[model samples]
Target chain A: MTSISIIGTGKMGSAIAEVAARAGADIQIIRRRAGAGSSLERGDAEYGLVGDQLTGELVVLAVPYEAYPSVLGHYRDRLDGKIVIDISNPIDFTTYDELLVPADSSTAVELSQALPAGARVVKAFNVNLGDTLSTGTNGTTTTTVLFAGDDPAAKIAVADLIEAAGLRAVDAGPLSRARELEAMGFLQIVLAAIGKTRYESGFALLQ
Target chain B: MTSISIIGTGKMGSAIAEVAARAGADIQIIRRRAGAGSSLERGDAEYGLVGDQLTGELVVLAVPYEAYPSVLGHYRDRLDGKIVIDISNPIDFTTYDELLVPADSSTAVELSQALPAGARVVKAFNVNLGDTLSTGTNGTTTTTVLFAGDDPAAKIAVADLIEAAGLRAVDAGPLSRARELEAMGFLQIVLAAIGKTRYESGFALLQ
Candidate 1:
């Protein structure tokens, strides 16, 4: 059984949690800021505050790109040795006109640099919209999660988590390839914003 | 009936020619340098050398980004009042590490500026691999062509050609959206180069 710790309570985080639940993994939700007092029992998933010690071998950073510095700072040395899943599309949200990361790099690469040396960064879920993941399908096409990482073992583990949820998982080369994935995400966002496409529709890897 | 004159008879040009054939459109294949004397006939499609006068209402630039200068110069005024379809990826093939175009503009935008004032430039087919377009299928999923352009009539003309070929055509907003589409093409190409994906597989937009 896999143990997963996800930080963030937004739509993306909630969407990923559904996958962990379906996998029967031990789910831990670490909020960036504790929500108002409705913290009663919500299924078998555990809840923790931002600075709380991470309890899962796999830590998913489901928050926005803007929250990375603060969240990564909170974890600091604690993230070492844990597989960190960075699912962020580091676009400047105010205008959404451009990506905030270096033109040559991606949010996943940036997260890898900021994390503790031993932490492995697996890039996934950034290419997907929350509604598609939650619905588990883009109409007839099943949601496929494209993940990339430098560590083979870490990639296998992340793929297992995603596959256990009955969704497809594609290996999109190495972590550096996240640059392309972020661009795909950016395109999806802008298309939806301009009403060219829908949040329910996204870039699907089809064989 | 719609008529399409394609500049460049490489794999990309051949693929678009197939689309026009299916659309029942009159097709013209223009070779950069006249091919060896093997030119007998290719169905109803006509063949021409570079400097030959273009006869179709729609001129498809199926050549690579590298040949743009010479090809464009050859057909400079000939492209006037034509719907010019640019399907080039603008990738630096020497090292597939980067897209040759600027951060803010796409090959379509550049072609628009370079062509005569009445020419309409539409960006399409660059996101697809030659294999996928040629085969008309990526295993189970059918090919979906995403096109962007400033001209509504041009986009519709290109979409009709694609749909007539039994593939889906998606309108990806205005010409500026070509930047995102080019990024999508870059990712697909690099992924294929690294063995992460296949030339027979590509980015499919699911409902």
Candidate 2:
């Protein structure tokens, strides 16, 4: 069984936890500083504090893009030899007019650069809404998770996790392709925020 | 019956012609110069020369973004009282690294400003691949055409045209929202180019 550690207890974090638990992975919910030890109401997953040793090989940073710096600072070299998933769409929330990251790079790429060399960064779940991820469906269509990274093994692991949860997973090429995924995610969020589309569903990649 | 004059016989133009013809719209195919006047081999669209007057009220600029200047200059003041559909994704095709227009504006907005005040500019079809539009399906799912414009009447006309062709048309908010649609379209094209996804299939907006 693949062990997973998801940081942040926001909507995205909770949604991913629901799916990961459904996939029967050993789940660890890390909420920045920690909360009620193990809340069975959310999921039957282990809850950890900031200072706790990162146990799961697959660690997901489900926090907002702004939290990466602090999270990485605390974890630092501890993230070595782990599969770090970056699911943040680094868009400006204040004006919703621009993205915070460099035009050429994505949050995932930036996260990878900050993490230890041994940490494999995979870009996934950034393109999905929290509601869609939790429901595992975009209306009648099964939620399709698009992921990208340089490591084949890391991509396979994340794909397996998503697929095991009764969702669809797609490999969107190298980590550089995260730029396109970020664009798609940003567009979806903007549409939802403006009431042009629904947050419960998003742009589905139908086969 | 609505008449559509498509400028450029490229894949996108031809694909749109197929749908518009099926929709029972009178089609007028206008190449850069002239064609074998009304070739029935390529749908029943009437072929016309550059000097010919646009008979269709719905003028589709199916040409590449680069040709917009010349096309607009040629028919500058002539597009009055017409509904012009701008389907060009203004991306730098040479490297696919950047979009050609300003970050705050879209090609449709630019076209709207360049044309006569009476002419209504609608942004549509830039989000779809020619093959998907031609087949009216993105694999098992029907192709959903996303359109945006300030004029509700123009949107209704385009929506009616799309629905008549057995495809889905979605209103993606005001003309300013074309930025998001362009981003989506650009992502799809880049994915196809990198073999991450198929050209015949695209991001389906499944309800």
Candidate 3:
């Protein structure tokens, strides 16, 4: 079984842990404190290794966009030679539809810049609702999850996790597509505001 | 029957025709040219007011965003005392995900300003897909269409047309919500590009 390490035990982080654990994968969770056994609770680790702390080939960053830089600083060393899946959207709640990041850059790009040498960053699960991720099924009719990364193997690894979670993994080319993906996320929220669509559920492309 | 005039007959315009006409409404379509009940063929009238002949309490601007200014200019005098629905989104196709209008201004806002005195402008039907309008049903489930306008009576009339076309109509409060609605349209395209969702459907609030 492929081993996985999940950072952040919040709503999305915990949900990813639960689903990944249930899918028959060996999962390790890193919290604020240190622990000896599996499934360490929050506030368990103090001054952890960037990449060496977790014994998994894949690491999932489930922190908020604002916390991304600090999270990377704490785990950059451990991240080298591992696939890092980014599921954060840098949204500016203050301005509603206006993006908080610069026009020429994206959060994924920012995270990539924060990574240590040889670290692979891939963006996925940014468009999906956290509630749906924890409760939905991956049976006959699976919802599509998009993944974009510079490394083909890294994308494949994340795609496997998405499929194992019972969803369809669609490769949306490279990391630049993350801009479009984040913009789509903003659009989804706007539609939800007007009661046109919901976060618990979303569109499935027919074409 | 409520008499309605559709100012453009393109794919979306034709889809609007299908919706309004199917509702048993007296529909008059002003194609590119001017004549006695002319077909939506090609180049009919010179930009504005197509022969200065139009008779309807309600007029739908079914043209492109680039043609919005000209369409508004032509109908300025004729649109007086009538309800005008602007179903256009000023999206910059060249930049893909960037907004064409300035940060403070929007396409609908511009149209509202260009209207003649006493004419009421409503922004609606800009988020729904043409195929969705044509199909009327999303995977065996009926969907909802949202609308926003400054005039209460005009919104009610538009809502009636939406219901007549076989979908639920949601009044998203005021015309200022148009910014949010237009952003939703942009998001739909982004989600569609990455295969995360279909643009042919909308969200319905349970509450």
Candidate 4:
């Protein structure tokens, strides 16, 4: 079984953890403090601390965009040589009309630059909502999970995980394409908040 | 019948004209010069000049983003009190990696600021590819036409035309929301170019 470590026990983190566990991955949950109850407890997953030694081949940063800097700073050394998957959408909450990152950059790109030299950063799962990710489908079609990373092997690994979890994986070129992926996420979130498609909607590319 | 004037004889202009013509709208094709051949002539549409007096209730600007300054400058008076639909995605083709407009602004919003005071600018059809707009469907699902504008009446008029053309019109809140719509357009265009999804694809919000 594939080993996966997920940080943060928020809605997105818990949802992704559930999906990974159901996919039969060896799941590990890392929390800020020990004994903190998590939704992962119901599954056969182990718990660890933020400062614990990393064991999983892939580590998912499921925290918000703002918390990335602090979280990476806390575990920078341990994350070396690990494939890091960024699922944060850096949306501006105050205005809710714009993204917090610069136009040319994305949360994934910025996180990649800040991480240790050996870590590989891949962007995935940002486009799907928590509820949608848990279900892996939006009624009729499978939820499309678009991912971007510089490493081909790393992308394939992420894509395999997505497929095993019952979702479709679309490789959106190199890591530079993360800007567009985050933009798509921002638009989807805004549309949902305004009651256009509600939060239950997912994007399907009809050919 | 709803009268519609399409400026510029490009692929988008001609495709929209075909859709409007099929929908039983009284269509007029406005070129830079009179008697200039247009694909729209293949349909039951009249040809006119850019300097000609504007008679249509709705004028669709299907020109490139770079041509908007020159075209809008020449016909500023004629476009007054007319509903202008911006279908240009101000993408930075030089890089094909980012949008040319400022992070806080969009092509539609910028065009609205430069237009005559009474002219209403609604961002529509920018998210749909020209071929997709012409067909109004991508294999299984009806193509969604997402429109955003400050004036409720103007948005409804555009939405009605979209529905009449056999597409689904999604109201994405006010004019400020055009930023997100354009971002969506930019992402879709880039995805098509990279072979992630062919240009034949259309966005479907699966509930």
Candidate with maximal DockQ: 4
- Cα-based lDDT at residue A53, candidate 3: 82
What are the DockQ scores of the candidates, in order?
A: 0.50, 0.42, 0.17, 0.59
* Model 4: interface root-mean-square deviation in Å: 2.3
Question: In candidate 1 chain A, where is summed lDDT lowest over 10 consecutive residues?
Answer: A33-42
Candidate 1, pairs of clashing residues: none
Model 2 ranges off by over 4 Å: A33-43, A91-104, A113-119, A193-200, B36-44, B80-82, B90-106, B109-120, B150-153, B193-198
Model 1, position A202: C-alpha lDDT score:
73
Q: Per-residue lDDT tens digits of candidate 4, residues A77-130?
A: 778889999999999999887788987788888888888879999999888888
Q: What is the alpha-carbon lDDT of model 3 when measured against the actual structure?
A: 0.68
Docking class of 4: medium
| Most accurate candidate by TM-score | 4
Model 2 chain B weakest lDDT span, ten residues long: B34-43
Tell me which of candidates 1 and 4 scores higher on TM-score: 4
Q: What is the TM-score of chain A in candidate 1?
A: 0.95
lDDT of 1 by residue, A1-207 (tens): 799998888778888888888888999988766663243335788999999999999999987788888887789689999999999988888976788988778889988998778999999998898887877886567788988899999999999998888888888778987877887888888767776557887777664
Whole-model Cα lDDT of every candidate shown, in order: 0.83, 0.84, 0.68, 0.82
Model 2, position B72: C-alpha lDDT score? 85
Alpha carbon lDDT at B149, candidate 4: 95
Per-residue lDDT of A45 in model 3: 26
Which lDDT value does model 4 have at A181? 82
lDDT by residue (A103-200, candidate 3, tens digit) is 45667777787787588989887766665576653221345666778888888888887778776777766787676567556555665665665556
Query: Each candidate's iRMS in angstroms?
Result: 2.6, 2.9, 6.1, 2.3
Reference-based TM-score of each model = 0.86, 0.82, 0.73, 0.90
